[model samples]
Target: MSYIQQSFSVQFEYKVFFTEKIFDTANTDFANFLESRAEKGIRKKLLFIVDDGVTKHHDYLQDQITAYFENIDGFELIQDIIVVPGGEASKNDLQLFYWLVNTLDQHAIDRHSYVVGIGGGSVLDLVGYVAAVSHRGVKHIRIPTTVLSQNDSGVGVKNGINYHGKKNFLGTFAPPAAVFNDATFLATLDERDWRSGMVEAVKVALIKDAGFFDWMESHAGLLTQADPASLQYLIRRCAELHMAHIGGAGDPFESGSSRPLDFGHWSAHKLEQLTDFELRHGEAVSIGIALDSVYSWLTGMLDADSLDRIIKLLKELRLPLYHPLLEIEDDQSAIVAGLEEFREHLGGQLTISLLRAIGKGQEVHSIDLAILRKAVNMLRDKW
Candidate 1:
């Protein structure tokens, strides 16, 4: 047998910028952001994909994008602004992906050209996938509009859509060329959208930063009132924590099974599917967080005060602590099925992250089924 040993390394760098009214031509930020990647005097072509929900809020957004790029020296905007369904609906349909690739191919969107996604996390995920797979990879920029996207998912290096009723069943590890969090876009969100995204802030704080959790506890009332200053800080701090974990954890790609960032995601993902995605991602995570906190208490891994604090914060934020689907069981499938699927997704022994304390997470290889069931019942009874 003949053997050839080979190895190589490549470095990737991108920036997450915070701004407002990015498409306003007077704002030099978007122009400069685009120009940074351009060759001397060369115009970079861009295809803009937006979420319909965003367009509904900012009716002039499509026009603004075209006008802004027209005035910019180093960028050209494609006339078409493709608007897709918002939320999980965007990721659930694979046909949308094929259409995006076809559009890119038709327009000759090469590796050097850009595909920009402006929307919530799901839209960004779908668009990122399309960009990554086109001509190996086109430079992709993410303008994450929602609190969840701005804070967590949009800033990360992962992109995916659900498949076979599984969360992120198909995806990639392609980071965006840049990320822009426009605080202005968040202003018009309905109550559900506004409140749902903040749970991610809670999730990250519970597992990684007790200080952050304490801060959230104190500002819960302000946050509930949709105080812009408080919400902006919430997004920035959560993004900072998430970025630190991705940069420092050395497992950005989930190359190992221990997904510490996904502390309560096993049941969260399953709950979303069981509800047929009627539940928003953050809403599901809120319930999952409550469930895991209770489980941790049942196992004596976390103290009661911390658990109470967690539940109290969730309630204050208007997030639900329990869902009926969570306790449902069928002959062939149950919410517990998520555990096995999650284990298989990570590809090795099961690793479930539980709270050891408010700011600390502990990973376990096995869970006591009876205790978990009891915890669910406890949550059901209380709610």
Candidate 2:
């Protein structure tokens, strides 16, 4: 028998626009976004899904969205905007996934229709999955509300929800039709969300741009204090770096094992699950970054000064550098199990990113278990 091989490539492009007060009719960003794709005499249906936390804070949000689309020649806003549980809770339950699909079906949303996910990263992940899977992919737009989403997750192409108690166990490699990062939604975030979101920026800076890391060091005070200009610049710069990596890495879908951007994510993911997601993503990342940095130091790969700077920056930014769960030892090396899980997740050899310097990273296939234990103990002592 003979075999036949076929190969083809598809082009992917989407705009990531930064705007404030997107739903205000006076602010034409949202309208412009929809109208850009409009055909003469054709009205596109829109299903707006809001996060419960966001609705609680902005009670007028649904009304505002309806008013914004009223009589808009290009789009029709569904009268009922569905609000779902926010945070990791939205991702942990698989029921919400089907519920969203059923709701879209009930509203007669088709491929041409738009599903706008408006909330933090979790809501975006869940809603984006719904849009990607239902009816073989509808046009989905992301309106990321939290600082974390605005800077990192919202800008990326990956969409995922937790499965079987694993972080991002079920997900897709689908990109949104567009990503609208509305800075206005950031103002209402509680202090925890406000501060935790910047952790991704620090992670990116430490690995790819030392100068950016320097900038973060200088403005750590402002970031922690919620300075608007500083935060805006941070988010934009972080998003730009992430987008650059995705465009240049030759692995946007992460088909390969080298995940440079996930420098601190292995432990972070495990920490999230171990804590039952009580630790916010960014907070868990902060600890992961610290754990990895200390491990790098232990292995003599990173200088003490660089490790000090990294830790100081995180602490100054009010990010948690140590979590007690990291020290927990049970029937197995609980936290160390993250290494195997991470490898399993990658579906190949273990590939981890460790610091070579403040602005650079190196990938390794395996980690020294003895050194890893030492790093955990070091963090415990500091705590």
lDDT of 2: 0.91
lDDT of 1 by residue, 280-383 (tens): 89999999999999999999999999999999999999999898888844423478888898899888999999999988989999988888888888889986
Candidate 2 ranges beyond 4 A from true positions: 328-331
Which digits, one per residue and each the tens of the lDDT, describe model 2 over residues 268-344?
99999899999999999999999999999999999999999999998898899888888845426678888899999
State candidate 2's TM-score: 0.97
- In model 2, which residue pairs have backbone atoms overlapping below 3 Å? none
After TM-score superposition, what is the CA distance of residue 145 in candidate 2 from its true location, in Å? 0.5
Q: Candidate 1: lDDT of 24?
A: 89
